[model samples]
Target chain A: MARVAIQHEDFDLSNEIAELRRHDKRVGAVCSFVGTVRGREEGTHGPPVLSMELEHYPGMTEKAIEAMIDEALHRFDIFGVRIIHRVGLLAPGDQIVLVAVTSAHRGQSYQACEFLMDYLKTQAPFWKKERTPQGEQWVDARVSDDAAAARWGIPGGNG
Target chain B: MKIAVRYFASIREAIGQGGETVETRAETLAALRDELIARGEPHAGALARGKSVRMAIDQVMSDEAAALREGAEVAFFPPVTGG
Candidate 1:
């Protein structure tokens, strides 16, 4: 099974795990990644991250992420996958994103977990702006993120 | 045709509004942008040359030459940095 959601609401980890394992008995390992709002700035002063305003291209964002999830499913021997991404105004320490994958063993689980995150960072069509003491500024996409995606041999792909 | 044009982040601040409907004979995304830039100094300064920006025509990725029709929604924003 494959699950993808672009939500403004928070999700329960245990419930997501349960949903992933509902029908599968051969699953032996479940790997997941949780993205949270951190306090420090990307590269500047460690400002208190009051909040982050996330704006996405709606339909385009969901389609792009769904495609990445499909790629992850194909590249690894995973049995199931789930991705939930939050949008709108989010405060610091709030859960921003989640990626969970399950498979017969740990190797596939770990690899899929890392791969999904790397791809999502570079290929998802979502934008984030941070609120600091100075003002709000748009976050710049990292070149290293592109490099990370390139290491996977997926060519000409960027959000 | 009249279309809703939306701007976000820096572009929004520069234009002082989220969006507005404009009537145009322009037929492509590039032409629409040129129309916006001709609106005044704010549009000209914000969407100036070499800015890292992307366009969406009715919620899909679009290029400068993407065709436009009646009642389309055109959105403009900087390159996404969300994780």
Candidate 2:
């Protein structure tokens, strides 16, 4: 399978992690992050989100993510990497994204996983639109996310 | 020269289209954007100066000062919110 996938299907996290470490005797650490759609935000009185629509720049989305994985490989001692981002209509509590990395040690695995996620947050070409009782609106980019990526020395949070 | 331009999310909604091919003499993304803005209406407003439109040339994130080449693919949209 390709290292990066932009799909509409919900992924099985365990299966993905297993696949990453399959047949690799030297692999000792696997770190992963899965992001899900939140129906409601904490301490906010806004209408609860009913669904989310994800839009992406097709060919560019996949290519951008693949490049990110390449960068991660170069910066870390990771052995395997898999990133999957789901698109289309999704209900609350649905999984939207997954970033999994495999390495020989916990340090490399952990760092690579976080690095990939921070990079994806600011650099990927995907846009999210939330649907609520009030109406549907495109999600705004957060400055904090930009800062998160910049902490890794990759500026331009795209926000 | 010819180039392809794409829009996403809110910008796509505002412009009422996803992408288009344009023929122009503009040498860079900034010049091309100015030319499109001259077309009036949504193009002028959605891609107006001071807007939060981010751009990429040939699928790589870049600044407006980056020179354009023939058949290059360009994109314009708001900041990305994806994780």
Candidate 3:
């Protein structure tokens, strides 16, 4: 299976996990993460988000995520990795991203999964724009995401 | 040298296009950005020094000090908000 995919369509986690672990007898643990669109802004009393538009640099997005997965493989003894990130317009509750990892143990898979996610959040070349009653606005990068990625000792300038 | 300049998100919107090819004498991304800003209008405001802009060279996240190359694909945008 391809290590990374940037699509406009939604993904099925079970299917992806199955593909990642297929024919791999050494795999003893599987860990996955799904990020979905939120309906409301954190501090805004404004109308809830009606929809969101995701934009990404096509070539760069895939390359960046693939590099992150490579880093995960190097840092953690993982067997396989798969990441899918959706683009285009999406509604509230729609799945935005997925990261799945397979390893010989649960601990490694879990750490690798979170590591890929943290790196992707700040490094990947994707941007989100939300539509609300107040009109449309581009989402800003969060400082917390930088802190999250920093825990792994990588600088996340996205903040 | 000629380079491909791409924009995304707010930068793309503000610049009114996705990308373009331009001939430039700049050697670094920062110099390239300053050259674009010298064009006035949207380029000046969108790529102003104080704005939080990020750059990529040949599809890799890069710093302003990164040197430019002929036929390079360069991108300028805001901090990413992806997951």
Q: Count the clashes in each prediction.
A: 0, 0, 0
In model 2, where do residues sit more than 4 Å from their true spots?
none
lDDT of 2 by residue, A19-57 (tens): 989999889999999999999855688789999999988
Better of 1 and 3 by DockQ: 3
Docking class of 2: medium
Q: Residue-wise lDDT of candidate 1 within A25-138, one digit each (tens)?
A: 999999999998887766875677788988876677788888887898899999999999999999988999999999999999999988888888876777788998887877
TM-score of each predicted structure versus truth: 0.81, 0.97, 0.97
Whose lDDT is higher: candidate 1's or candidate 3's? 3
Poorest lDDT segment (10 consecutive residues) of candidate 1 chain A: A150-159
Predicted candidate 1 versus true structure: per-residue lDDT over B8-67, tens digit per residue:
766777788888899999999999888878887888877765776678788766788999
lDDT of each: 0.83, 0.91, 0.94
Best by DockQ: 3
Worst 10 residues of 2 chain A by lDDT: A150-159
Which residue runs of candidate 1 sit more than 4 Å off their true CA positions? A42-44, A153-159, B69-71
Residue A99: error of model 2 in Å? 0.3
Cα deviation in Å at residue A6, candidate 2?
0.7
